[model samples]
Target chain A: MWAIQLFNGLSYSSILLLVALGLSITFGLMNVINMAHGEFLMIGAYMVYVTQHLFQQYAPAAWFDSYYIFALFVSFTVAFFLGMLLEMGLVKFLYRRPLDSLLATWGVGMMLQQAAKMIFGAPNVAVTSPSWLEGGLQLTSVVVLPYKRLFILALVIVCLLSLYIYLYRTAAGRSMRAVMQNRDMAGCLGISTRKVDRITFAIGSGIAGLAGSALALIGPIGSSLGTYYIVDAFMVVVLGGVGKLAGVVFGAVTIGVLNVFFESWLSASIAKVIVFVIVIAFLQWRPRGFVSLKTRALES
Target chain B: MKQGLGTINRESQFKWIVYMLILGMMLLAPLFLSDFRLMLLAKYVSFAIVAIGLALIWGYTGILSLGHGVFFGLGAYGMAMYLKLEASGGKLPDFMVWSGQNELPWFWMPFSSFFLTLLLIVIVPMGIAYGLGFLTFRNRIQGVQFTILTQALVLIVVTLLIGQQAFTGGSNGITGFKTILGYSLSDPTVKRVLYWITIGVLALLFALAYWMTKSRFKRVLLAIRDGENRLRFIGYNPAVFKAFIFAVSAGFAGIAGALFVLHVGIISPSMMGIVPSIEMVLWVAIGGRNSLSGAVLGALLINYAKTTFSEAYPSLWLFLLGGLFVISVILLPRGFMGLMKDGMQKIKKRRKREDANENNIDFTFGESKR
Candidate 1:
């Protein structure tokens, strides 16, 4: 029983980590709070829904189950382009003002949510998981691990590994890291800070999209789905320490474990409240969070 | 220097007259407005009170709380509990009975008294704000970190409220009050009285806020906003000051919440969630954060606009509200009041220039005579 609970906690943490990564990345890079980050995730989920419909209508019967792969890519690409467009049109101007960016992005988020409501109607739209994801890996009579969760875990691992390579191995990643370390110094070294910011923000948004795509497999997608997850995602980013991947992982794991542990004894909402209190209490001790990078930049 | 002081005095005098005129108009609004319109105005005025508190903290102190609705809700809930208990008349609230709560919870015991409820309305939110502000500020948490923490606080409070259905009426929240202090709530006369009481409280708080802004404390707040480290170096504890102002702000919000409950006749968890909390901030942001009058005007105008817009074009309202947020932040960072101030300053500057040109000629004559 404990093993199953632990697995469930870990599985939940993986989803949280995915959602937090995008927000942490953009926030770390630009000091801009994109309140619309969640909307991008929603867009991604809707894309999956769109893909599922297209596959049913156009694709061969045998190929229907394979549409999940195409949906993930489509969601990521669409969200990425939209993020880039938003960066250029709205977020770029508010780069210097973090608070203003938060409000503006929130406005953008509201508009997106309203737009989604108009397009998809108010009720939650269902997207069925592929047949291969059905059933569980039966370990014991009392404990059976779901295949869908295992798939999600695998997907998360793949995302993290690829992200790790992208950040550490690539030249663009090097430039991105330099900017994150010190924007002025990076700009002085002839790196285009503007381009880095746009790409980084878009990538973060795309990550959110991917998370949303994964989410569609688990349950129905609604206009408010993004909002429901956004706060929790933000909590992960904050508690893990902003701008640090390791911090996000640590935050997610801690929250997921604590949430599950408390949930076993209490109601879900009460458990969530407990987790929030713990996060706030933890911040009282470590205001900079668990993995704050030492830098000379006073404002940062 | 003497002329500058003279102009400042005259400008302040003009401002007071305008304040009085606005107050007079509000007092006389019942004559022209129907009962429903009067109720709406009262609701907006209560919001204005919340905006006033927001202006003090966000505008003056440079601390933005995204969970102010938590404090507002606390106040509203306090009032609602008292009213709810009174309505029940020695028995448990209807929801409590329905939920199979045999006895009133320990927390609900104190709210049985009307006076205690009123006191709690101010004190409870103030206490929470002080505790929260002290914890975060003492830890040197500011800016986005502080904002995120407050947002989390809202989430916690909302979750807790929703979870305790037996105690808090769950997501439905505390409502269905038929009377207040033995008076029928449905009576138009009672509503008019409540409206008057609300305005009176608002005016008193507004005066207190104005006085605080004009005091030496305002300079300290501005200094903290500009340079907290420097202020600390100068021997002033920024945390204490920040926490105190935050507490005061929460107190104002609490009062506003109580007033809001009276007018709206409902105190639900949804009203104090993340969206409503942020919307409260929006009022301050759009009105002009630094000025009390601007904050009050912002709350009134934006809420009025919200009601009208949503009623007229429900689908497009969010788009317009969103556009307002973007436009206000990007184009009018200082808000409508900021724009108005700039225009006023420009006219004043032109007048000063003409006055200076005349003085220059006179000075030249004096030099020649000497």
Candidate 2:
């Protein structure tokens, strides 16, 4: 039973890490709150719904697992283009003013939610797991692990590993890191900071798209589901420390484990309250976040 | 020094006259307008009061608290709990039974009394704000970081309210309130009286805030807003002042929420969500931060426009609001007040130039005659 709970915690943490990583990068590197980050995720979820419809109409006989792959690709592409458009049109002007950007992004988020409602109606749309991903793997007489959860966990690890390599190894990654540390200094050194910002934002939003696709597999998708994850995602970013990739992973794991333990001990509502109190206490101890930026350079 | 004192006195007397005229209009408004319009006006005034608190914190103190909806919600819920209990006639509310709660919870017992409910409206929000401010300000969290934390706080509170069906009325929230302080909420006479009471309370709060701002305490707040590090180096503890002002601002918001419950007769978690909090920030932005009168004017004008726009073109209201935000921030950085001030300065400059030209012509004529 204990092992099952532990696995459950890990599974939950994996999902959270996938959802929050994009937000952490955008906030840490760009200093943009991107209140519409979850909206990007919502867009991704809707894309999957659209893809499922297309598959049903045009390719009914095709393998069901193949549809998931197509949907994931479509989601990333759609979210990436939308994110780029938002950055170029609205977010770029408000880059110097974080507070104003927060308000504006919130407005964008509201508009997106209302638009989603108008398009999809205000109901939870069921997303079926593929036949291959169905059923649980029984580890012991008392312990069982769902295939979908395991798949999500493995996917998150692979995404993180690739992200780690991309951020730390490549020349483009180095330039991006330099820009995040100090925009003016990087610019003075002939680095195209603007391009880096646009690329980073796109990647961040595309990850959110991937998160939404994963989330749809686990639960019903809806217009307002983004609102549910936004707060938790933000908490993870703050607790893990901003501007550090490792911080996001740590934050997600801690919150997920704590939530599961609390839910087991108390009601779900009380568990949320407990998690909030803990975050608040954690913030009190480390206002700059648990992970400090290695370089002390002001970007804005 | 004496002349400066006299100028200040004259300025204050002029302000008093304006206040009296506004108070008189509010008092006589119900006599002319229908009860429904009067009620709508009262709601606007109540929101203006909340905006006033927002203006003080965000406008003057430079602390943008996006979670003010939480404080407002607390006050609304405090009043709703009392009204719900009163409506139940000493029995458990229906929601409690539906949620499998056989009896009212211990924590809810105090809210049954009107006095206790009112006290909680003030104390509860104030306590929460104080605790939060103490934790956050001491840690020196400001800017977007602070804003996100407050947003997170709002999410937690709203979710808690939605999930706890028994205590908080779930997603539907607490409604169907009939009376306040033994007066029928449905009765027009009671509503008129409530309107007058709200106006009186708002007037008193304005006076208090105005007086406080004129004091040395306000100078410190302004200084801190401009340069907190400098103020800290000068031996002032910025955290204490920030926390105190935050508490006061929250208390004012709580009062506004109480008034809102009396007027609207319903309180929902939606009222205190992240969107509403952002709307509150917009009110301050459009009005002119740092000016109390501007804040109230901005709230009334923007909300009035919203109501009218929503009625005329519901589908396009969000687009209009978004456009307004972009236009206001880009064109009128200091808001409407700044634009007005700039216009007045230009007029004054043109008039001065004309006067100087007239003086030069007169001198030439005098010299020619000599």
Candidate 3:
């Protein structure tokens, strides 16, 4: 039972990690709040749903087994481009005004949710996973690992590895890192900081979109699906400590484990309340989050 | 100096005229308007009360609390508990009985007294806000952390209230209120009385908040918002002020919640959730977050628009509200009142520019347009 629970927790942590990565990258790099980050996830889920419908109507019977793969790419591209457009149109101007940016993004979130309702109707929309992704790996009578969750876990690892390489090894990634460290200084060093911000935000948003596609495989998609996961996603980012990838990993695992364990012991609602209370108290203890940024000036 | 005094006097007079006009309308509204409209106006009045609290915190102190619904809920629950007890004829509330609770909970027992209930309705939420504010503010959790913490607070309170089925009515919430101090709540006369009382309470609170804005304390709050470090260097602890205002704002929200229960005949966790709390922010944002009058006016205007739009074209309501949220922050950050204030200031400035070519008349707070 404990082993199964641990597996469940780890899978949950994958989703948390996926959500947090996008938020942390954007927030750390730009110091701008994307209150509509969850909306990007929502859009991604809708993207998958739309792709599945279109494929079923137009594609061959043999293609049904791999429709989700096409959906995944489509989700990422649509969300990536939308993120770029939003960054250029609105977020770029409000980069210096964090509070206004938050409110504006929240407005965008509202509009997106409303649009979702208008287009898809208010009911929860979902798509079935491919036959290859169905069922679970039965290691033992009591230790069954679901293939869907395992696929998600594998996706998380792949995304994390790619992110690590892109952030640490790639030229653009290093320049983005320079911008994250200090915008003016990075600009003085001849890096195009605005381009860096736009790329970072787009990448971050695309990751959220990918996470949403993964989420659609596991559950229903709705206009307000993003709203449900958003608070928890934010909790992961904040608790993990912004700007640090390791901190996100640490935070997600801790929160995911605690959530599953608490849900097992108590009711789900009570567990949620307890988790929130713990996070709030933890915040009091470490206002700079689990791992404080080395730059003391920004902490203030 | 004489011109400065003259402008101050003129401004005060202008403010008094506005207050009297509102007060007169409040007093005579029931006589002129239909019962349904009077009831609607009462709800808006209660919302205005919440906006005043919001303006105090977000506007004056620059502390935007996203979980104010928790405070409002506390007050509402407190009032609802009292009303439930009264409705149950001193027995267990209906939900408790249905949930197999035989005895009244210890917490619900004290609410038997109307005065005690009223006192708790204000103080309990304030107490909660004080406790939370002390930890958050003393730790210097300002900006986004503070906002997120408040949102977390709302979620915690909402889930707790919804989870404890026997206690908090479990999503159905504490409702079916029948009377207030032996007066039938459904009675039209009683509702009219409640409406006037709500308007009176709001006006009184507005006056008090307005006084606070004009006081030395307001300057300190602005200073804290602009430069907390500089204020701290001046040998003042900013946490105390923040805590005090947070508690005060919570108290105001509590009062509004209680008034809301009286008007709406229900108190549910729904009113204290993330959406409702965000709606409070929108009210102040639309009113002009920087002005108390703007806050009240914004609440009335938005609620009126909401009801009108919902009744007419329900499909367009969210779109309009969403647009308001985006536009208010982006292009119209100061809101309607702010725009009017700017326009008024510009007109005043232009007039004074002409006067500069004549008598060079410009002085005091009201004359800053020049």
User: Best-fitting candidate, measured by DockQ?
Assistant: 1
**Model 3: which residue pairs collide?**
none
Question: Which candidate, 2 or 3, would have the higher TM-score against the true structure?
Answer: 3
DockQ of each model vs. true complex: 0.70, 0.44, 0.60
- DockQ winner between candidates 1 and 2: 1
- Native contacts retained by candidate 3: 0.48
- Per-residue C-alpha lDDT of model 2 across residues B283-356, encoded as one tens digit per residue: 87888877787778888888889888899988767666666666666566567877776797677556645865
Taking the tens digit of each residue's C-alpha lDDT, what string does model 3 give over A135-194? 999999878888999999999999999999998999999998888777788999999998
The numbered model that scores best in lDDT is 1
Candidate 2's C-alpha runs over 4 A off are: A295-300, B1-20, B89-104, B311-327, B360-370
TM-score of each: 0.97, 0.91, 0.96
Task: Quote the positional error of residue A239 for candidate 2 in Å.
Answer: 0.4
lDDT of 1 by residue, A1-300 (tens): 789889989988988888888898888888777899889889999999999999999999899999999999999999999999999999999887787789899999999999999999999998988899899999989889889888878888888888889889999999999999988899999999999999998999999899999888888999878887788878887788865678888988898888888898798888987898798799888887878878765656
Q: What is the lDDT for A300 in model 1? A: 60
Model 2: residue A155 alpha-carbon error in angstroms: 2.2
Ranking by DockQ: 1, 3, 2
Clashing pairs in 2: none
TM-score of the B chain in each candidate versus the native B chain? 0.96, 0.91, 0.95
Instruction: Give the lDDT ranking, best first.
Output: 1, 3, 2
Better of 2 and 3 by DockQ: 3
